[model samples]
Target: MVVMWMVTGGAGYIGAHVVQAFLDEGMAVVVLDDLSSGHAEFVPEGVPLVRGSILDTPLVEAALREHGVDGVVHLAGFKYAGVSVQRPLHTYAQNVTGTAHLLEAMDAAGVRRIVFSSSAAVYGTPDVDLVTERTPTAPESPYGESKLIGEWLLRDAARATADDDAPLRHTSLRYFNVVGSGRPDLYDSSPHNLFPLVIEALLAGRTPRINGTDYPTPDGTCVRDYVHVADLARSHVVAARALEAGTSLEPVYNLGSGDGVSVREIMTTMADVTGIAFEPDVAPRRPGDPARIVASGELAARDLDWRMRHSLTEMARSAWEARRQA
Candidate 1:
């Protein structure tokens, strides 16, 4: 039988790319998105787009059963870290409660495999130069805390179902700065992410502002691991295949570049990619902003075929082109 997967939030930037990746692999997919932050237009034609929140247990369960979903890629959540700080209750409601509800529905529907879309925010401000799976988690934002809790939910659920005929197999991919676009029609529309912030500012003839220039880094700006959305999306397919094959995967894998790119460097690349010439306005550090957070994708690389397939220039250029098309 052909495996059918449900991509929650499948119309969002990353989720849409993941949906495309599944299609490229000849896998059947159905999307379940509330169109809250996701664009309905991003979901491709012929794929069923269930327009409902994952919080609706009956709706999700019915969708799962009706579609014969064998696995789920859970990406539906409140995603902004900064905004999450101001709206902790809202964040918890969407990410934490929403994940719990999805799990409940999956349990009811007998969907036994899941690939969770987690965040590096779960690590908060890591002192280590290269974050690994061993890095201690100290989530600073409610968004991060909620993602960590979601992972806990999966772990505890798997433990509870260990002896069952079909145990709940799962893996969480901890994303670090997912940028760029896999297709021109699908671009990051997030107001909070760096790529869209810079791209939107330039498109409006405004100089992009860097959050901080006094960070403890080579360029005095915050550093992060930037990964292309397509590359990140491809790994989700790999994880799904692993689960379907009953292959044991680590509970969590960091999908990262294993290298750091500073904010100023990104500014230069954006300028080069877009043919815009302007210096970024230096602003005070955003409170709670970490100086650096880069991670090694060795585990993901070994198991999920994860790697940096796109260069930094390609990341910036693809993002700019897609946003321009939008």
Candidate 2:
């Protein structure tokens, strides 16, 4: 019998890439998304997509049963870190409460395994140059706090159901910056993310502005690990496969590039790759912006075959092509 997986928020950018990655491995995929931030076209043909929120327990549970879902890739949540600070309740409703509801549905349906799309925000501006799985979690925003809570919820659920025949096996992926595009039709549509913001500005014939050119980094700008979306997507599939085979895995993995690129370098690469020859305007740093925070992907590399396959130039070029197609 073939294994089937349900991808919540699979109509979004990262989720769409993850669906493709699973398809590449010959796993049957079904996507669940409310189309709030996700476009229906992003979902590939032939993959079953259910248009609904994960909070809708009956809807989520029905999708699982109807599709014979063996596992789930939970990716649906409100993800804007900055805006989450102002709208804490809304963030909690979507990420925290929504996660609780999904777990409830999973339990009701006896779904045994899940791969969660967590964020490095759980680390909340780490002090270490290379954050490990042991890094202390101190989320700075409601969004980060909600993701950390989601991780805890999964753990608690696993413990509660350990004695059952269908024990919950779960792993959360943590990363800082996700960029680039896997296909021409799919591109990052986030308003707050760096790559999309820059790409959109240039396309509108406006100069892209870089926040904080006076940070303590070598380039006097903030530095972050920007991983290619395709590479990140592949790791998600590997994690799912491991769970399907009843292989034991750590509770979490950081899909980070040990080293990182500064915002200035990103701008330069975009200019070179797209032949947009205008210099970016330098702006003051946003509040609570870290000077540098890159995590060690060693754990994920060992367990999930994770690695940064694309260079900065390649990431920029692919994203540019996708944006043009958008």
Per-model CA lDDT versus the true structure: 0.95, 0.92
Which ranges in model 2 have alpha carbons more than 4 Å from their true place? Answer: none
Clashing pairs in 1: none
Candidate 1 structure, TM-score to reference: 0.99
Which segments of model 1 are wrong by more than 4 Å?
none
**Superposing all C-alpha atoms, what RMSD in Å does each candidate have to the true structure?**
0.8, 1.1
In model 2, residue pairs whose N, Cα or C atoms come closer than 3 Å (at least 3 residues apart or on different chains), thus clashing, are none
- Candidate 1 per-residue lDDT, tens place, 284-304, comes to 877656788999999999999
The model with the greatest TM-score is: 1
What would the TM-scores of all predictions be?
0.99, 0.98
Best by lDDT: 1
Q: What is candidate 2's lDDT per residue for 1-326, written digit by digit as tens?
A: 99999999999999999999999988899999999999999999999989999889999999899999999999999998878888899999999999999999988888989999999889877778788899999888898899999999999999999999879999999987899999899899999899999999999999999998888789998899999999999999999999999999999999999988999999999999999898899887775466777899999999999999999999999999999988
